[model samples]
Target: MYCVSCRNIHMFFPPFSHLTIVSLLFRCPWTVMANFKGHALPGSFFLIVGLWWSVKYPLKYFHRKGKSSQLTHYYQRLEITEAAIRTLFSVIGVLAEQFVPDGPHLHLSQESHWVKLMNWQHSTMYLFFAASGVADMLTYLSAHTPVGLDRLVMAVAVFNEGFLFYYHVHNRPPLDQHIHSLLLYAVFGGALSIALEVILRDNIVLELFRTSLAILQGTWFWQIGFVLFPPFGGPEWDQSDHNNIMFITMCFSWHYLAALCTVAISYSLVHCFLTRVKRHGEREIIGIQKLKSDHTYQTALLGGSDED
Candidate 1:
């Protein structure tokens, strides 16, 4: 319940502060590499994809009567691009999970040393997403399945990610366990939403809800990086502190609220913007009562009068 001012004169104009943001991204310090940056890479991926769904779904839903919101060729291209990005990022995730010098004992019980099972778990999680992307790409073939194969594939991927993380936190710090558990809520929620999309087929409300969950996961990932591994090499969190654990839970609830608000605002803005411009061959759909009113403008052209 405290508000702290980040207000500073130098920061206002010159881009002050350690650029902890930039350092969090680019610096090569060991903690930044293994902890913050690792979390952030996928965080960026989810955030961008969420924004894509948030924007595209609304445009499609609010299309004008005379035309589709997006042309066939363009929409197909966008789908291809989305799948490609997902696959490429997932591949990168696998690499990052395994290739580090001290990571992922990629062999089976190699003389009972360097088991590093967690590393392999993460790599396998990344592979699931890569599979989801491949399934999405197959849509270009116009292959018909009884349901949305891409959606179901993505749902499986989300479920797999959650499944891994749920077990990944065993014997870890209280703070780490609590934060990651919060993340599972979004992960499983998104998984269920995607599954429902496969069943419901083009339900806009579910689409928007899925988008919100995605953004929540993305933001939560970044927040996790910051909470467990403070930027600019700031002091580490007291993992055992009860108050710290309590605050993290509250912070997560706020993040959920923020994610919902983000989608709501984005939807509202797109609606307002789309309403202003009339599409080609667009005709107004007005009520019959309004059409009978001589004071109405479109009615005058149709020769309707109050008495008529």
Candidate 2:
């Protein structure tokens, strides 16, 4: 039998334990989305871009038949088009924030400097997206593609993502912690992939990892929408039973399904391009032959073993 004083001491010490402290720092009260439109808009952008990248890379890889130096910039026209669309979306989002008087607009003219800063914080995510868009446009528009400029763009994206992660972690409620944490992981993973790409010059695996993270990010956006918004049982902010294991399992299962669907769509698109597009088909065939020849020559030089 434990003494009452000892029991009290144990309880007190447990609350101050490292695990408890970490949980307190990382966790917060559950929060519902007040500005659904703002989230959904950027969410859509990420989803579309992610789906495109995931599909584009695989098709490009097969088309080039593993001879390409850099799989990323192979489709120059598509890159430019994506950049233009991102820039357009960023501009529109910014403009809407500035002009839209009724909706979730930023309160930039608060009397208190602290309040003004907080207002800026609210819009930082969009601002970072806009900055990234501008950087992407500049990257594509440069007359002479300098390595430094490319690194700078990647660095800016990394910083933006880091900031976004912090914002979501602190500002979002505990109920949404899992979704936001997944997004943070995706952003951080993307940043790491970009850094690796910059260092390694061109790594196809790293590029694919980056695109996979993008797909995960997009999937999280839809999950957040479904969990926080209407038509799917409404927000979970006020609920105390958010730690349902079955619900969590379902959420992850949905993500896996979404990823598989994206891959299938990408493959189908690649097949269509190879079958219907005359120029692309011809180029791919030539590229494949060249790759085979190169492999054979390397194998012969290495005494019939291409391992080295």
Candidate 3:
């Protein structure tokens, strides 16, 4: 659904050639509906979740380091709040997909069916995530909904997301397909790790791997936005250029490396900071006990009553 005007977005992606790039540059605004906002929104979500998990899983593993506990992973202590946030984001996605002026507004018929096929697809993806959130909420409140149902649902959602994206950008330009296909690596990797979480229960390795992939997803989404839309007022990529595609692939590798470094840094900081805090606390307690012992000895040596 490529259009010359700014109002209509083309696949939340754009530019197949130099001419097309120029057109998008002059026509599209900084916040193009084509997919910049879309990518950034979800990117921010993944980034936050990834960073949080990065800190949390490491902290949990360190805290439980010599303990004889069957579980040694981050637990969803704020399941209720987490579920609410997930549901809220999904709802926003669905509403934005269906209710914009150019949107079909939920109308699916012979005449209106082709209005925006991708929007419907996007809505369906969001629905699965929303279902996962609801499942988490139910698991938190209900006693008989089956253990690990929420995790299973979330794994399905992430899998479905990758499945959709795999089929979403086919027959498109080389650069377009290449850049988007890069996302499949993160999406599918995260999906598999999350599915593993369902089976492994509290395996910190699987959880950490999932969080690392999530960080990749977050950063890559923003990369896609810059490649496709270029919100910072620059020329768009040549969607048919092999050099551009190769560069993007290389750049994606860098993004993954950066994500890994970020995860490692997060773990190190949490471990170091918490370890120092714990050490200081133990020293404080020992100092207090020693003071009490010294006071008792002095009173006894001075011929004071034992009670004194």
Candidate 4:
């Protein structure tokens, strides 16, 4: 409820500064490693295979079925979700911005005027999420069994992602939509925590390297859990194949790493576009709408009314 200005700048922080102290707890190195080892491999593979399946087939299916609007509508939903999350994090960023200038745990401010320049970056990111969600749905349908209780569960999960995408694409994307709103964020934030741990010290790479091995082990555990444990039925892997575990484990690790990198790179592109589009002409062009408006003016071409 209170606003303060310092040196020609105005900022807002939550009344409960004590609440934000929890973010400090995230600074611990071992905790980050635990998180990385938890999902680095399994989460990564599941995400990639999921994405690939989504892209390769469902897109065509949707297009053929004339459900492109469903796709667009889903993207719109994701946009709204992004807007909401952006506002929440923007508030948090405003509160934490003052702390970034001092050390290893840097902060990014959402309240800065320059931050508004990131709008296109945010919008494009929403588009990616919407697109990815559609792909996920397609993959879910194409890869998983389409008949049974397990099928229902996968459908629900895929639908949930689709719903989020719908919300995001409609609302004019805000910055935090994809990362903070989904479980995928947990996977990413965990991996990033590991990256930061490495950056914090000269000898940290070995620790990170070791963490990757642990991740591979954990990924195998996840595959076994999902495969052998339930209504979904055990994996079709032949019990007689001696190298199944080893082969699956390596492939899983590769896919997992690839998924993480893909999402990270996707976001990086979002940031890059944001940086380039920050200004009107010098590399960050913003006047296309103006040019569009001018073309609407009554001209010597084709008689006069706005009814072209």
Candidate 5:
């Protein structure tokens, strides 16, 4: 008979088992291995996209000589290449789901109800992935893009991620539940940021909050992999009642460090790219200066022409 508790233990405590090293390395099935891949894949997608968006505005602001509002008004305008990369990642995630053992299949009715529910849970994430991918592609194609649609799609994706994260937290063992719980809140915060952006229409702070949460989630995925599936045989924190406060604080600290590092790296790379493109740099600077000069000339003419 299959034992659910035994399966959960095996899933979380693979190293603690009394298996030979060779067996541990080779005998673990793909079903077991795919869990890490599942998290890591989406984690990478969010990390890259978040890193780009987090740096995009700051780079533009700097390029325009500290005139932040001189560029395009809306923030949803992303480079076509970057948007395509995000879409590609989402597509890959959707395709990757097909290979997972418990993932959704063509024949749903044949499966047990419990199996069906599990499959739905797994498939839901990728469905949202596909939705996000299409939305991004649409953004790339549209000349006159609507900010509301972009915000709505982002809101949907964030909400879906938040729901799945909460579900995982609820099912996690007590030892690991707190970390997942924090992650759930982070996801919600990202969703809230998106929602606020939808209402406020072009706020840098909201966009930063969303991107920050995405990076945090990406970093936490690696942390979960390390904590649950250690390199050697056994998890780092094996006991259910181990000291939780210190670890949680450490996780938060790691997130802060990761965010700072990601932003710095992204900013440096963006600045370098902008500097290398001579025509792009010259055109932006000239355009902003011309606009400023024209505004000044118009103001002087109006003041001089007016009869006091």
Candidate 6:
């Protein structure tokens, strides 16, 4: 299926003028209600499972006792991902201009405002909260659950997996590389949401509340992701058979695709840096091994090739 982005970029998408007309015909109460139910059921299910895992298993894998070096390493990883997300959101907020309509109809395309920046920030922040919440739940479940229940975890792993699938299909990344992009996107999204709330003139609790609402609303993008490219081993159901296809097809997915793409680019840069460091370490190890082998060979030569 052609993406809204593909349509918009190619100038094939209908103008915003048709939105009202489409809203009356295609976005009626029945469709709206169906979409809501689609969102509500999966959302509530995830919430319940997340709460259960969080409460049932409170141990944090990120924390290490009596290992300052390990703690430092973990902190470094955290800081790197944090920076990646921030930069990702910043770039995304900047590029948001390109996707917006340039026609005389849309005001957002004309100029960047503090308010728009705040909204973009908030969107990222909310995405972060949701992703962190998922990670928290996954970590807890991994710690507490039996190996046999991996199936269930895989079932719900749909949320993250769906995001990855969408990333590849939308961005056209290789399958092996898509996970890295998704992980970075997830981190950037979470950070952006927090940045939004913190940057705005809102209380901490109010900001969190707002971020939560955004998380809930934005998760529909995942559902839409699931619909657009149903993953391998997914439950038996056709995308067209789903009732909320319009919600999946329309502006919501397009907005998220941009956000995810923004996050992915930032992640790629940051991850490249991290990978280079890792490669340097590996190369050092290989150099040491080669030196040791050369020493052994020289010793054998000094002894006239072989004792025999």
lDDT of all predictions: 0.80, 0.61, 0.80, 0.38, 0.66, 0.40
What is the per-residue lDDT of model 6 for residues 1-308, given as tens digits with 9 covering 90 to 100?
22133235336434545544443433244433333333343344434433322221111211222233545545545534543443453344334322333212223333453333323332343344344434434433455734323223332333343443344334332331332233344334433444443344323333333233333334543454344334332553333343433433454545445534433453355455555876898899999999999999999898985665
In model 6, the runs with Cα more than 4 Å from the true position are 1-20, 23-63, 70-74, 97-219, 224-308
In model 2, the worst 10-residue window by lDDT is 25-34
Per-residue lDDT over 1-308 for candidate 2, one digit per residue giving the tens place of the 0 to 100 score: 22233345457676566555544432322212333554565667677777787777677767677465574564766766777787677677665544443333555654553332422443565566666666666666786666535535655665675665566546455555655565666677777777776676545576666666677666676666666554334434442356653475467667756765776677677767766776787899999999999999887889845555
Q: Looking at model 4, how many pairs of residues clash? A: 22
CA RMSD of each candidate after superposition: 12.3, 15.8, 5.4, 25.2, 9.7, 17.8
Better of 1 and 4 by lDDT: 1
Per-candidate TM-scores read 0.76, 0.64, 0.83, 0.24, 0.68, 0.24
lDDT of 5 by residue, 113-148 (tens): 344343455456767766766766676578676756
Kindly report which residue stretches of model 5 are placed more than 4 angstroms away from their true locations once superposed.
1-31, 63-78, 101-111, 116-119, 143-145, 231-236, 268-308
Output the TM-score of candidate 2.
0.64
lDDT score of residue 120 within candidate 2: 47
Q: Model 5 TM-score?
A: 0.68
Model 1, runs deviating above 4 Å: 1-32, 64-70, 105-109, 279-308
* Alpha carbon lDDT at 36, candidate 1: 75
Number of clashes recorded per candidate:
0, 0, 1, 22, 0, 10
Kindly list the per-residue Cα lDDT of model 3 for residues 108-215, writing each as its tens digit. 655433656777787888899899999998987788888888889998999998899899898878888888888998988887787777778768888888888999
* lDDT, candidate 4, at 41: 30
